[model samples]
Target: MRALTAAAIGLAAALALVLAMTAVGAPSGETSPEPLLTTVPKHP
Candidate 1:
């Protein structure tokens, strides 16, 4: 019984976090999905 209650609480918290983020519209000017860097310098 104790384990079940703990699991339910954790699930609720996670759902709340997701909803909050969606409501906030992500962080302002934040890099969406981050950027990938893989460029080589050109030789002169």
Candidate 2:
């Protein structure tokens, strides 16, 4: 039971670390402005 508890805690810590890293390393929406500007039609 103790081992299982430790394993679960470790897994949770690892998942949190991965999520934090991804959130930090991911690109911001402002990085790409062309797509947002060009997606709409120029003419009616």
Candidate 3:
């Protein structure tokens, strides 16, 4: 159906926009911090 196709296209476009924004805002090179998970103490 045309409606379903349109919805899928809109969703894809929104997702791409979000990804682009995230990429643009993200830190690059040496300034990036180590991932938080690595800093957490592991349980025995």
Best by lDDT: 1
Instruction: Write one digit per residue (lDDT tens) for candidate 2, span 1-44.
Output: 99999999999999999999988897656565555555666786
**Shift in Å, residue 11, candidate 1:** 0.1
What order do you get sorting by lDDT, best first? Answer: 1, 3, 2
> Global lDDT of each model?
0.89, 0.86, 0.88
Best candidate (score: TM-score): 1
Model 1: lDDT equals 0.89
TM-score of each: 0.61, 0.56, 0.57
Per-residue lDDT tens digits for candidate 1, residues 11-43, read: 999999999989988566756696686787688
List residue ranges in candidate 2 displaced over 4 A.
26-44
Poorest 10 consecutive residues by lDDT, candidate 1: 26-35
In the range 1-44, model 3's lDDT, one tens digit per residue, is 99999999999999999999998896666854755565668789
Question: lDDT: which is higher, 2 or 3?
Answer: 3
